[model samples]
Every structure is written in structure tokens, then in C-alpha cells.
Target: MNRRTFIESMGILGAASLLPISCLHMQPTTNYKLGYQLFSIRDEMTKDPIGTLKLLKKLGYQDFEIYGFDAEKGMYYGYTAADFKMILDDLGLTVSSGHYGFSGFLNAPEDILIRFVDQCIQGADTLNSAYITWPWIAPEQRTLDNFKIMSKKLNIIGEQVKAAGLGFAYHNHGYEFDDHNGQNGYDIILSETDAALVKLQMDMYWVMHSSKYTPKELIQKQPGRYVMWHIKDMDTKTRDYTELGNGSIDYTTLLPDPIASGLEYYYIEQGGNFAQNSIQSATDSATYFKEHLQKYL
Candidate 1:
């Protein structure tokens, strides 16, 4: 049977029967590390990547997920990948993942797509990131055909990333859940791609905003597919970005089954509408994680 068919037949049964009871209760074997996405402080990163890293370190963030890798410049936020790696090392921070746009893969010629993937692999290797993620799909390119094309390219790129000793992932936005002839873009991508090659980095706010599936339900439906999570909360009223504890998602319920969810790393990401200063917002999220979320970890 195909991957999607097999997944459907198993349903929640597979996840329920296969997952160890201890996964729901056992503490993480290693140190529980909390991370932040540098996009949360894009302005600071643009002005001074080093200063941003230092401040994030001071806020008790040990890991990060970065964005804006310029393939042509061979840099992220204007620093060469190697230089950025050095800065991270000096601050005792690790970049577990980074976001890269896939426009070249979607629109460029085959040779250009190959070059883009090569650049991504090189940058990811330099930063020692575990996953290099495709983070967005433009509104105009949300068709099923586009998703199919993306799936094929993602599988190809994922293989190259795997060969380079890293992983490839897709980061979700609410658009993926939009209905398309009864099969959403997300369903197409998940079903069409090789699971071993393409992992998922689920954003909590987007998942909630989609109103289709909850984080826990998605985990149960597609066990071991999601490897990373963007932990942003939705305001109860506006359903927009809010600091961790101040929002609507009861992470307390969703975070306990990391093994079942295939969650290896999670980064707190607050996108705009910060309750206070962005740095302070990040600190508050970190504080909540340390005080409340660590128990699950």
C-alpha cells in the first residue's frame, strides 16, 4: 500500500497501539533545551546579529531557528554561514533549524533548483542545523498541482540534504489547510512525499487558526512525522500571536507526548503583537517554558 493509504487504514489505531505508554509520562533523557526563532527579533538581527544572539543567550535561550538565508551572498542576515556559526558558538547557542524559501525550487530551472539545494545544504552544514525548512508557499501558488510539484522537489531536495548529513522539513501556515477539491495542500504534500525524506515543523498558532485539527490530533493522525514545533500561542479574543502562557493553547495538554509526536526540538515564536518589548516577550515565553513546560520535557 502507498504511504497515505497505509496511514489512513491505521488511523489513530496505529498511533495508539504503537506508542509506548511511557512516552506519555517519561521525562526526557537529556537536558530539556528551550529555543527561540530569530525571526521573532528580525529587526535586531538585521541591525546586529551578534547583539541579538547575545541578548537571546542572556534571556536563557540555548538554541535557535534562523531565517533569511541569502544563497547568492552565502549568508544569513548578512554574515557568512561560517561566521554566523562562530557567533552562535561563542554565545553557547546552537541553531537546530533554519528556514529557507523554495521559490527557486518552484519557479527556477532544474540547474537553478540544484544550485539552491546545494546552497541550502552548505549553509545548513555550516550552521550545524539538524533541519533546513521550507517555510512558506505564496498565496498564488497554493494549488494542488503546485503542491504536487513542491512534493516532488521536496523529496529530491530532502534526499540531497540527507546525503549532506541533515534533514529537510516543511513549515506549515494556515493556507495549507484550505480546502482544495476536498483534499487540502497539506494532505497532498504529506501523502505524496516520502516520509523518510520530508519531515514537518508544525506551527501551533497556524494549526489552531486553521480550525481543522488540533496539535494532538495531528500527532495522533500522523505519528512520527512532525520533528519540530513552533510554539506560538493565539490570543483568546483575536486569535493572534500572544506570549506563551497568556494565550489560548493549553500546551500542558499537547506537549506531554513528544515521542509519539516525533518532536525533537521546539522553538518559541511570537510573531508581532508582542505584549511588551519583543525581547521581553521572548523572555516571558522562555520563563513560562522553564517553569511550566519543563515538567513535560
Candidate 2:
């Protein structure tokens, strides 16, 4: 996916749990796995994937959701799937999912789309990733008509991914919540895609920023279908991305029941608007989450 458009498109789009603020804020705890999307530290990973993973692991992040798989080369960060997996293994880190570039095929022919999806599936298998996620569509393709077509393709892709013993999910941004007359793109996605085949990867920041429904209410609409989550906080004044606990979202009350949401994994992500720098933002978010938000998940 194009990281610049990932932020700039009309720009859009936002999960969770309940734990009292007083009860939280404890010393760093263990046993639970916290995930961070590598896209948050894309620059660092590009320069030094090994060093970046090592630092993120030291910050108490155990699970990861990766982005920008080079489908043509069948590589990630210039490393083959097996090699990358080995890197994570040596670092005591796990990558359960990834944001692949499937959105580019939104208008491509079936055969082309299938070819790309199959490539993504192979990469996922090599890494033992449980899910291959479709991150975002280009802004021009966000029309209601395209969403309908997108939903159909989602089912087809989901069927193929599921056949390979993996899960398929669509990650939402603010654009999906844009009102198209009475029906929004998200509505079409939820209503048209088969729940058994296509799962939802709810980005809590976009849901809150763009959608009218609260994260809890959105899950209530289709509870078990949501298999993944992108957890990020929104800047209070500019509505941009900020480090966790330094933004407007109130996870203490906003996080939905894990059981209700079919919550499998959640990743802390900030595409842009970092407080200091990307790596520091990742470390800061990790610290904030361990102290304040880990218990809720």
C-alpha cells in the first residue's frame, strides 16, 4: 500500500475494553502478548529490519502485524519469508498477520486479482501468518458501486484464503464510512460479504473518526465477524494520529467486550503525526499500553 495515500485519502478514518483508570497504571506486567503494526516503524524497518525488530521486542511487544510485502519479489524488507521468520524467531517475536497490497486489484480482472492473492497466501504461509489482510483501497475507488464489487471480490478472496487454512480480513479507513446516499461502504461490506468467509479487521481510530457508531455499537451489528483490530488514538484537536493515552479516545469505556467482538488480535498503529519520531512513538505507545491498557485486552 502507498503509505502517503494511506494517510491523505479524503482522508479517513478508527476498538476495545473496560478497566477503571484507577485499577490500571500498574507496573509492567507479563503473560499477555501486545502487538504493534510494523508499518508504524516503516522507515526504521526499511533501514534495519533486524535492529528494529530487536528494539520493538525489548519494548514489550511480542506480537506483530506486518505491512508492505513485496509481492513481485516474494520478500519482506528485502528478506525472503523464511529468512524474515527466522529474524522474528531469533528476536522472540511473532507475526500473526500482515497488511498486503490486495486493494490495487479492486478493479483488476479476476485472474489478476487471484494471482496476487495467491502470492500473498504463499507469503503468509511461509511466515505462518494466520491471516492475510486487505488494508485500504484508493480514494477514487471508494464509490458505493465499487464497494459492492469489492464485497463480491472479498467473498471470492476470502474463500480462497480460507481454503488454504488461513483467514481473510478487510481493514477499514475513514473512507469506508463515507455516506453514499443512505448506505455507506461499510454497510455494503458487512451486509454483502459472507461472515464465514470474510472477516472484519476493525480499525478503532477510523471507526471513531469517521463512522457514526461507537466501536461497541458497530461490533453489536456483527459481533463474531470482527476477527482483528487496529488500535490507535486520535489527536484531540486536529483529529490526527497521536501516541496512545495522549489522544481523545477513552479505551477505559470504549473498548468492546473481547468475547463479543470475536477479538483475536489487535495492533497499535500510527501511520503519521508521530509525537517525536516513529521508533520513539512505538516505544512510547508500548510503555503506555503496558502500564494503562494491557489489562483491558
Candidate 3:
């Protein structure tokens, strides 16, 4: 059977969950294991980082993707990188990847660029994550020339991070989908960057919500460049963030070409509407993916 057929055959096994390990026809790999970017849990984290990590573990997360590690603070939420790493390790969770904002470096004085880059490098290295990302672009810097400038600088930033032994990526939001000279900024980033040196972390929700392109089309055309993906969902009525599979995206079509798309990790993100709080939002996403995504797998 083909990969898709094999997955479809399982169809949400009930006996398998209770049976011995050997009887299982499907064993999820790290590739398919559900993970959440800590930013989705940012509010809970601000309240208590250690408590948040414990809660996420209880909610069935084995992998994590983090953001906003202020080097100055020496901790993300009053927990040092070493301290935070220990907490995750004890819970059998791994920090798969994270967002590393480079706008500060891109906008800082020349003398301060290296300092900012070093700070990012320090946090990424400390966490042992595979990819560090520049999360978004400032609205005012939307001109074609600025896009080119951003690309050149990102390429430079990729080189610097790669030299430090970590991969570099750009994470998209809806703004990058807007047209400039009838071409999008995302097009420029894709065309200008060296694929070997840089990777793209496709934010599927933003691409779908803002642009006409679908995630599958982007992966098909840009194969091997998208190393990570933000698996966010959007409600059609409000165009706002929602739980996975509870929104309009067709994830079945999206995951089948994982290898072709060069995807290593997929991180769940819900920008806001943490009605119950961040950990609860994460648990809802993880639970949804576990129960519903298998059909699509």
C-alpha cells in the first residue's frame, strides 16, 4: 500500500490504543508527533514557564517550538535557558525549533548587528533547536527595494547562523502575501535566497488567509526549501485563528507531500483567542490533531 493508503486504512483505531505495542499498524514518528510553538502559550508562559511546560506535557506534547528568548533576561520567562532545557528534558519533551527575530539586527546600527546576531545564536544553541526564524516584516518596509534589502540581509543572517551550526529560516505572516509591483515579498524571498544556506518556514494559515496560493502549491513549486511549517488554522467566517481541523484548511492534502516539501517539523500556532488560556489552547490543538489528523495522514 502507498503511504496515503496505509494511513487511511488505520482510520482511528480503538483496539490499538488498548492493545499491546506489537499489534499497532501505525506508530507515529517524531515527524507526525504533535508539537506546539510556545508562542501560542505565551500568556501562560508569562505567568509560569515551568508550570506551563508541565501542563503541556500532561496535554500530550512530546516536542516543543519556542520563541522570544531575551538574551538580556537570560531566561524566557524568568527561567534560564539551562533551567528551561532541564525542565523540558525531565518531561521527555524536546525543543524541536524556534523563532529568532532578526528585525532588531536588520534595523540596528552596523556596530550592533553582530551583537544582536550573537544573542540569537546563543539562545538557539542553548536550546539545541534545528532552525531559528525571523518571524515577520515591519509593515512600513514593504517596498520592492526593502524586500530586496531584507533578502540580502536574511541571506547574510543565514550564513552567520549556519556558521554557528544552526539552520536559519524566515516565517511568514499575511503581510508578505501583499503585492508590490504586482509581485509578493514572499516571491522575492524565495527567488533571492540560496536554498542550501536558507530555509523557509511556511505559515500555512497566513498563506491561505491572505493570498490565493495553497500550501500544497507552494511546496510543489518550492520543494526542499520549506524545512518547517506553521500548522495554524483559520475560521472562514472571521478569518481568525482557530483549532486544527476545526477550521477550513484541508490538512489531508498538505501532509502527504511532507518529504517533497522538505518538512522536518510542523509547529501549531494560534495567535490569540486563548479563551481558556495558552495551555488549554495548546491541549485543544494537540487533541484535535491526534484524533482528526490521522484520517488525513
Candidate 4:
């Protein structure tokens, strides 16, 4: 989905309960949540969330990062939070996090932001999601000034999320790396936000595609602040998102220390440019991830 449709909607479990495998002295991979961003197969999800989830489970996915939240209705896809949780529970699946429509309220009043955040909390509480993520900022709101302003809002939302025993995170896109003199929007977000309150969700594709910093370099900027990741590959020729391993990113060697990243959960995502179709792309990526990357993660 594009930014508008993504925003048109929009934490949970605490950090302590989600100790990273790397931090656990190379504990079994089963102890960690291997997830996929539903946006990668959004069409199938919209058509049949249950069946699509079942397919993902069969493909070895155990956790999910949800999207297309209807905040006004407190619904995901078309089911209420309670109903959706029941479905996941029945399937032996879990939601590690959610991508909510937070950018829409970037400039709204405190009351408005609070009201919306409370609504988000309700759904996340029901689903037991680990983090509620602010995925994107509209193009017009990407200015350096807005980046500073957005960081303040992140702290505000992060406070509420923490208060409710949930975590709050921000997911980055390529645009965040856009340079203004020597600094960029990401520099402001990393510096201005309260690390205790707010966390970072690194989209590796974006870091590889644009940022002057590599994934490891970015993680070094804030050791334990990065709690989640969106792993995808870029088309070698066009540099667009593609099925994992079908493109140029060699995650086998590219991954940083999960312990240092303070990582808990990660989602495999493909925004578009699927090799054949969305579900096929998801299946293919899952296969590659399980065979080549899940061990590293």
C-alpha cells in the first residue's frame, strides 16, 4: 500500500520479555519470532487474512507485523482486535508489531494525538503486539524542521506506549536519508528523540539503498535503541523492492549483531516489484529466508 492508503487507518508486550537470541548465548531460533510484514502480501490479506496467514505459517513464519489498521473502528483487515487475536491464537501465530497511521497526526493538537494513540493502544493491547510503529511521514512533512517536531511527537506517543506497558518505534524509508547540508532527517530523529521512550525499526533496504551509513554503522549510532527490523532486498538494476535473495542484498553477511541491535522481532517485507505475484513473492522470500537467513537472524 502507498502512504495515503497506509495512513488512512492506522505496542504491547514489554521489552524485557523479548530477550534477543543473540543476547541469550545463541539460544534456539525457535525462541525468536520470525515474522513477515503483511503489507508484503496485502492483496491476499485483504481477500483472506486467515488463509493467507495459514499459508505463511506453513511457509515457516511464526510471527507477523500487521498493517491496514482501521483506528476509528478498532479493526484490522475487517475483524475487531479481539477477533483477530483469536484467529492468530488458533493458528499458533503471533503479531510482533503493527504499522499504524501515525504520520496523519504529526501536526495535530496534543489532544488529537493522544486520542488517536489511545485508540491504537486498545488494539495493540488486545493483540498483545510488542510495538506500535510510526511507519512514514508524508512528503510535505519531511522537512528538517518537521523532523525535529516529529521527534517530539514520537516521545509523546512513546511515553503513552511505555505507560501502557508497550513499546513505540519509528520505521524508516529512503526519504529519511535525504541530505540537507551534511545532516539528514534521520540524524534529527536519532538525536532529538528520547532513547528511553522511543525505539527504532530499521528498514535495511532503505539503509542499503540511500543512507550514507551502512546497516552496521546505523546501528552503531544508537546501540540498543534499534529494536526491530524490516528485511527486504533491492532489485539490482532498478533498485526497487524485490523478493528476498532474488535481489542484490546478501543478508547472510550483511546482518549486524542482533544482541548489539537489542533486536527482538523482524519482518520480511517487499513493498512492490514482485517477480511474479505477491503471494508467490512471499512464498519465495520465506523459502530463501528459512534456508539462508533465519539462522543468522
Candidate 5:
């Protein structure tokens, strides 16, 4: 069955009874707490890291996942990890995790792995996060052999990270699902990697966009491997992202087995939102989750 039908036809044990209360409750409740990806506030942060963080605190966010940090300036935009962490802590927010790219994974000299691990350790220390995530792969490096190479490297990285009292995970963009010689890269990674070391941070919107499979099916297929998610909704008609709950991704239904999808932390992201103000966009998404996702609890 197609995704829409697959999700629709599948019965939730308490869906009907749950819906009315979830949809009708006007008091503003929270089922699942939410997080913001620092990248979403890149512009404002680039201009003012401390200021932007203060704004986020004002927005009522309690957790964060960073994507970039400018060491020289001591910030994600210009503050150091410690400085940023202080802001988050002052607001009673935690920095759950952050995304690093593939460069560290494919280091030049083999011994560089030690230095790489140290760098990740330092970053994790500053933020007090237990995870350092690899969030992307070079588009051209999409191949079975490349994936296998990455899997091996990631296993090593994961081991190193674990030793440092932190965890390691790979985040997906849509490209990972593209068929490479009849095999999906994500499937390859899952099948071949060390479960104890490497984990998956599935980006639900991208996974849905890629047409590889349904989010629920993948979660069911590999329970507990997904430890986090990048949550956003898709405009079914436009085949693009929309604010959460304002679009068609039925998060309510998905919540019954959220942990099954390996979800421990969920961050809100929108790759594009041309019309709305960026902060407003994120605010709307968070508000939707606070309202609609409450039923899942």
C-alpha cells in the first residue's frame, strides 16, 4: 500500500478515543517535549549567538541540538560551546546533541582518529551532550562500496566516542535512501554496522520524501536503532516541507511507537519556509507539537 493508505488503514488501539481530546483540548498541553536545531536559527545566530539563544529561551524551548560551532569566536555563531551551554542552562535547557559532518569520519592520516575523537569529546563536554552526530554524506559518495567504507569508519568512530562517555549516530538526508545497485544505503548501514557503537538519527521528513519506505515500517524493522529524529511535516500536495501538524504527517499516529523508531530526542527543522519569518516558523511548529502530539502520551 502507498504511504497515505498504509498509515490511514493501520489501526491504533486508542486512536479514536485519543483524537477528540487531542484535537479539542484548547488549554495548550504537551505530549512530547520539543527541541530546536541551531541551524534553524543560523542567520540570527550568525548575527548574535547569545541574543538568538536568549530568544530561543524566550520561546520556551528546553533542549537544543547544535549543527555548527565557531571555535575562534566561542559560539555556534560566535560564542564558544561553553558560552552557548551557559545560555541554555540559564534558560533551563539542555544541549542534547549536535551534528558534525563526514570530514572527521574520512580523515587523512589514520592516527588522526585520536585527535578527531578528542575534538568530539571536547565539543560534547562543552555542551554536556552525550552524543555527537554525523549528519551528512557527500552526494557524489553514494555507493555501496562508499557506504561500506563509511560503515567501517563509523564503527571505529562510534567505538571511540563511546569510550569517551559519549554516543555516536549518523543522521540521514534523503539521498541515503536512493537505490545504489538495488540496495538502499540506509539498509546497508543498518545491516552491516555494530549496533553497540553506531545508532541512527532518522529524519522523518526526508525519509518520507525519498520514497524509500515509510517511517513506521523502518522503525518496526529495526527497533531501538533510531535514537533521535529530525521532525518536520511535508506538504503532501507540494511534496515539500510545511510546519508540523499544518501539513500531512500524522505524528499522532506515529507516537504510539515513537521509541520503536528509536526516538529519544526529536528536533524541529524546515529546510525551506520562504514566506514565514524563520523564528515564527519554528514557533508555529513547536506550538503544533505541543497541541497535537499530546495525545500520544
Candidate 6:
């Protein structure tokens, strides 16, 4: 089904009956790390990163995942990698992963792509990020041949990032699941990329929104391939952003096998529509996480 149709057809499930039967046996893990994606509150971050980070830290977040890395400026949210690292250090937070745009890899000259990757590796190293993630592929760039080319480019980039002593991962949206000749872009990505050199940052919301697979099934199908998770929820009615525990996704079923999924870090992220204020949403989500989800982590 197309994305729009899927979203409209999937009505919101009430909180009292949201958990799926599959999640009944799932249990939490003590070894997991909980983090917040900066994108969850991008407005606050863009205005005052230090203040924003301090607020998040105070709200009980211990780790961070950054997005919108500017290669030209060698910065994230207008702070150089070194500066950003220092700020995070002072707040007692560490960056686990950062999303890096891949348009350069797709459209830039060969030399430019190499330089971009090199710069990204250096920046990630400075921030002590465990993973440098390729976060999005523009819709116009999603053809079958483009997927093949992107897969090859990702392998090369992954090898370079691996050599730099960091992991490389790709984040997905529902579009990657688009069917092409009995296969899909996601299938190509999985088969063409070197699993040893590249890992996946699974966005559970998008996976579910695709209406093609469940997070648990994907974890089982490609064990050890996913290293990080973007922990967001889908509004039962709109299929849009919502805080964890309030949405239709059942973390109870998915968090049972972190070992099987190779999940080390999971970050809370709400794309745009916060239930209340951003800070309040984050605070509420964190509270729900500690009270409901922390035990399973």
C-alpha cells in the first residue's frame, strides 16, 4: 500500500488495548543505554544548544544523538565538533551517533565525496560518536539504479569510517520499503552493503508505517545488523509523531531481545508535533521511559 493510504487506514489504538500479543513475553534489559535525539527539540537547540542540552540532561537523558551536521562549517548546530564535544562533556552527556547528510555522496564530484567523508570521519571522531549515520535519501533519488549506486557508495564510505575507528549506519524512512520488481530498496541495501562495515539505525516508527514488517520481525530477520534505534511513536490516527507509550507501537514486544537485535542505544525522538511543549513532551517521554520502558531496557 502507498504511504498515505496506509496512514489513513491505520486508526489509533486506545492506550488500554495498544499492546500486541507478541509483546507479552518481552522483558527489559539493564545493559541498554537511553538517549535523546537532538532533532526531538531542534528549535530549542538551534537557538541555544548549551541551554537546550542542559535542559535535556536535567530531564534525565544521559546520551545524545545529533543531527544536521554542517560539513562546510565542521559544526553541529553552529558549534565546531571540538566545541560541541566540550559542551556535551560539561553536561555529562556523550554523543552516541550523529546523522550526516549523504547528498554530497550522491551528487558531488568523486574528490568532493572523498573529502566529505574524510571531514565527517574527523568530526565524528572529535565528538566521540560511535556511529556516523546516513539519515535520509531524497525522494527524487530513490530509483533502482540510484539505490545500487548509493549502496556501493555507502560501502566505500563505511570502509573509510570503519578505518577511522567508528561505525557507519544507514537510517531509513518508509520509502526504502518501496517495491521494485518483486524486491525493494531496503532489500538492495541489505544485500549490497557489507554488513561487517555497515550497520543499521532502525527507525521503528518508519518500519511500522511501511506496513510491511514489524520491528521484532526485522530484528529477527537481520540479527546483529541494527546497532541503534530511533525510538519514536506513531499516532494511531495520523501515523505522525507522538511521544513514546502514547503511540500505538508496543515496545513491550520489541525490547525483549536486545542481544538478538544488536541494539546498544535507543534514542527518543518526536519529529514535529509534540503533544504539549517540546520540553514537556520530552520530560513526559523520559518519565514514561523510566517508569515503563526502563526496566525492559
Best by lDDT: 4
Per-residue alpha-carbon lDDT of model 4 for 1-297, expressed as tens digits? 787765553312344337543444433443567789999999999899999999999888899999889999999989999999999999999998999999899999999999999999999999999899999989889899999999999999999999999999999998989999987999899889999999999999999999888888888879998899999999999999999887999887678778778899889999889989998998899889888777776
TM-score of 5: 0.83
**Residue 42 in model 4: shift from native, Å?**
0.5
Native-referenced Cα lDDT, model 4: 0.89
- Cα lDDT tens digits, model 1, 168-267, are 9999999889887788988888889998999999898899889488887888878998999898888999998999899888887766377777888988
Count steric clashes of candidate 3: 0
lDDT of 6: 0.84
Which residue pairs does candidate 3 place in steric collision?
A: none
User: Where is the poorest 10-residue window by lDDT in model 5?
Assistant: 21-30
List candidate 3 segments past 4 Å from native: 1-31, 294-297
Model 1 lowest lDDT segment of ten: 21-30
Q: Write the per-residue lDDT of candidate 3 for residues 165-259, one digit (tens) a residue.
A: 99988888888878766898888988998887789898888888887887778887888888888887887578788877667887755453566
lDDT value, candidate 2, whole model: 0.87
Query: Could you tell me the lDDT of residue 1 within candidate 6?
Result: 89
lDDT leaderboard ranking: 4, 2, 1, 6, 3, 5
State each model's CA lDDT, in order: 0.85, 0.87, 0.76, 0.89, 0.74, 0.84
Go through the candidates in order and give the clash count of each.
0, 11, 0, 0, 5, 5
Give the C-alpha lDDT of model 1.
0.85
Off by over 4 Å in 1: 1-23
- The collision pairs in model 4 are none
Best by TM-score: 4
Clashing pairs in 1: none
TM-score preference between candidates 2 and 6, better one: 2
